[model samples]
Target: MRNKKTPKIFLASFFLFSFLPLMVFADSQAESRKFFIDSSYDVANREQILATNKKVSSKAYFYVENDWFNKLEDEDKITVEQTLNSLAQEFDEVIYPRLTEAFGPEWRPGIDNDYRITVLFHQMKEGYQGYFNNGNEYLKIQNPISNEREMVYLNTDALFSKNINSYLAHEFVHLITFNQKERLRGVIEEVWLNEARADYAPTLLGYDDEFQDSNLQQRAKTFLSHQNDSLTEWLGEEKDYGVVNIFTHYLVDHYGLRILADSLKSSKVGIPSINESLKKAGFSEDFSQIFDNWLIAVYLEDCSLNEKYCYKSPNLKKLKISPSLIFLPSTLKTQFSLNYSTTFWAGNWYRIVGQEGKLEVKFEGVPDVQFKVIYVLCQNHQECSVDLMPLDNSQKGNLSLDDFGKEWTSLTLIPSLQGKVSGFDGRENYFPFSITASITRENQEQEIIAQLRAEIAQLKA
Candidate 1:
């Protein structure tokens, strides 16, 4: 189900700041204090200075930009205060405990030496819901621009929205990820997997159980529009979130939360981390094999065919890909060919409506690149069957179906690049491939002979 109007997409930023020496603030119940803000999104000004008034809670501190707070009406200000207080309670009771239990903890006794996390609310650039900066976890001597605390920055505009809690859960995961993977393990987690965990945080916290207007619902809509986006590439775009959110949902739905938790705790990064976790869990399927199953699952989300072919989550039970390209074979046009390229782990679907004849398909791809070709054969009012089209050393494969038109009502070809297991640097590598299909009718012998005779008689005359 697609929303008619644009959704308030929750976008969070994870940025690393350079270490620089700066004055640090001591723990206090101060009325106001100056803080460093990231102004990279602001084109007109690049100043990183702001003053905020603090609201203290048992487990956290909420700071709102003084200028923005001053402009709001008295009643609106009261509402903002209530929202922050509620968020503080939720964080202490829900987000902190749940995430820490699952993926480990944020740097404990952090830079501030207090068990309190800081939440800063300011007018950020449009489209940004919030962000978590690891710089805040370092001392002033290590990072000059550091706030020397476990802090998260939220856009002032989101302070009043119901989705603010979800934003907090998302950013808080990044803080924990920084500690779990980078601080403890001394390795940077891949951006895609990092974001995937954050995107799944809402679901883990039961925020997405409502489905409507939930982050998961919005991501589902975004994914339907941009299904071709690569799962491993991290461009920090909305489409990137869509891909990671849904893919992560599918992963956790089947493999359980241990996949995420164990992978984060592992010393390895990205694909290797996930593979290591899978091996430890005693699952025979590796990352590549799971990816292939996921490709089919996205197309035909029917668990009846195979448990791996569908999402067990009720929210995503109906989610499936609708191929944009469709081929119709007829006597006038008996052959069709398509040439295109795709990034690694991207899903491409092509549907073919066969005519009454034998349908033949040949797929050719770059020899150096690994390709996985899967075809789903569906007959009217019958269960569909899925199988792989085996490619030889040359990365070429052929498929022939004699009952394509009569027995099989439709055929969908899903092709993906399974190469490049690790080290995805947000670069787009397009692997070009082509698929050619032709149909041969059973009664064509007499017609060809008569046509040839007519052509020969005419040529003699």
Candidate 2:
């Protein structure tokens, strides 16, 4: 879910002419009140309409579109009631405390002074779960388009599903972020990090403790399909959610939740905020180091080799990235070359396999772009060892190994862009690189000659 901002000049003009009337009518305790909703999702040709208050709790006021609520079946009404009750209780007992403690508090005693956040349910454009609009925090004189309250707008369809609570938890974090980062700090957080935090909300609330059909499980599947998705890019697609959700999970799993909390409380935003938190926590690793380790951890979730290379969560113990390209060398086809492109912080894995030969790999990347090339060698019945490939100033490196397919079962090359740490835009962000791997039978020939000499000696005997 994304929040939208309106231009300041238009808002100023609307407020000057209508401020007095809006303030006089704002205090009316009517059964229904006019609210402005995003028209992008609404099928109706209207953006302003009256929504009736259906239920009120200590912490929230649940409102539904007047027409939609009136037409609901009796059984559907009961389900909505049950869902709202569960949501209110969870928000009060769990979400409110945990997120507020981690991020910060949302605007208090909000606009109406009732201390209750508003939850509005209306028909939204399909595929949208929910969103939090910061415009609601302003008065009519400041933002004439404001809902003038702390509120989250959810799709009516969510009420009939099991994911209602999780959706609410996600948007609630946005509200907290508005106050913590934008309102108090006067800095807008990068969309990628903002969505990352919100996507991690369900897990933070323990809603994903169950692996089956849980948010974490679904995101894991999505990430596997698009494992190369740039972690810093926010395209507002499912792949974006996939990358951020799993990355944040791995982050909190290894570093603890303090990184997220401290980052939010810092004046810096995005990667800088994370780096600041890591420094304050007395850790030598920065954002780049953590991301580098994460690239390996996702590919090889083996804690036996190094604790930093795997996840502590049992649910993610079996998680690993499948190789993007698999190379099997034969006498007929002894060499392979591949040229591919990737975005910043995105990873590509190349696996090489051959028998009784020397494997030589040459890598050439864009000279100006920073790249980290890591080689993972897995031997038969032995633990895998990870090492970084040394690249020159021209961003070129080579690796030559003997006993390919004999002592080693597989070798995986992982290359990722490490140059850009901040200011990531998805447009034209692809970085291209080439990798050439060739297998030679020089070692095989020497072994064959030794065997032939031993046979000749046996015949003479």
Candidate 3:
């Protein structure tokens, strides 16, 4: 996916998945099954693992690398199969008990023993190692090519306090959150809350002291510190260990896990579906409000210098006065750049162009003020120049010099398709607009909070 420019903000690359080649599957059942079995052994080990907790699918397939086969002894080959079976059962034991408790007894074990997880140990180039979607299954590759090996290395030196368990808890939650019927996977927002709720499952299962560790909270702390400018982009893979884990931690700490889990029971699976789950929670307040509250608290606490994880200062926070500040028509057509000017710093805006009908801005700043009042200045129907408006006498809609004097304020202005013009014809892809927000200090400019940018990518027919 390509990124568009907006405002005077700093640009960052958003990384999630590593691009890889697609693996084709055999149509013949016997061949597929043979592939699965051989893949699980070493030269010293052989034999297909027979699962105990769940019935093994008669047609399940296993895949193995030729190199492991070259080194294993005949006896060790048997051990490999036994090990696979043991790992499956052990994984289930560690996982199901927690899932069943959180999701309720009705939640059944893996649907259709037909689902299979492929194991691999390849000398991959120095980089990430983990599972990726492979057709109907997941490929768990062990990359020997990694230099850091922090995530993929199977090491005896690794620590396993409750904090680490939360990591495991989070990933396991992802596994459980999968819908076998639709073949859904990963931590999309709707499912994110589920995993977030599960993040506390370790504590519920009796691991409290570790939950209190300063190191454990690093995940949430990192996200809380950077919410404003780069979360969507900053939350790339390398930083996920903390961001995802911490979001999960926050979910449980503020909203009880049971409430969070109950919220997820009926929740949808992707970003948009998150609202469905939030609705199930029956909290009259919107999820954004709740998120803002949690975000504000986190940012303020994490910004402390004494804290292990401190957010760098000198960040620009942008707040939008409207759904979007419309820019003059751009038939330059293919691309547009967005920029923001703040007394504190110069920020950039994200370009809103294309058939994807929506614009989004993430307003980020230190938390201190109780509320914000916004003003959108634009020519009646045409785009108008927005003079930085002051926050004083905002209830009266007036501005003065006091507002432009501060140095730490930033507003991330975003736009969503509006009016009858939302998405009609090819025009539905975009609405031309340029916009920016003026920051005001309600209390003292201490809290740093960021409003996430969202563009409605789905179009109605």
Query: Given candidate 1, what's the lDDT at residue 254?
Result: 89
Give model 2's TM-score versus the native structure: 0.89
Which ten contiguous residues of candidate 3 have the minimum total lDDT? 148-157
lDDT of 3 by residue, 1-461 (tens): 00011112111111211322334332232232222222211233343222111123222222334454346687865665565454446435664466656754311212222223322332222222222221212212322111111111111111112243333344344444443212222222332333344445554555444433533444444444433322222212334334444544444454455555554444344323434555655655444444433333332333332221122211211111122223323122323344332211001222222222122222332222212323232222133222222333211122332322122122223222111211111111222223332223343223222211112223321
Q: Model 2: residues >4 Å from true position, as ranges?
A: 5-30, 43-46, 111-114, 380-382, 425-428, 443-461
lDDT of residue 408 for candidate 3:
11
For model 2, how does the per-residue alpha-carbon lDDT over 4-92 read when each residue is reduced to its tens digit?
54435332343332233223222322268889987875657467768887777667777888888779899988888788788778878
lDDT over C-alpha atoms for residue 461 of model 1? 100
What is the C-alpha local distance difference test score of each model?
A: 0.80, 0.80, 0.31
Q: Model 1: residues >4 Å from true position, as ranges? A: 1-30, 42-45, 445-461
The number of the candidate with the highest TM-score is 1
Candidate 1 lDDT for residue 329: 50
Please give me the total number of clashing residue pairs in predicted model 3.
61
Residue range with the least summed lDDT across 10 consecutive positions in model 1 = 1-10
- lDDT agreement of model 3 with the native: 0.31
Candidate 3 to native Cα RMSD, angstroms? 18.7
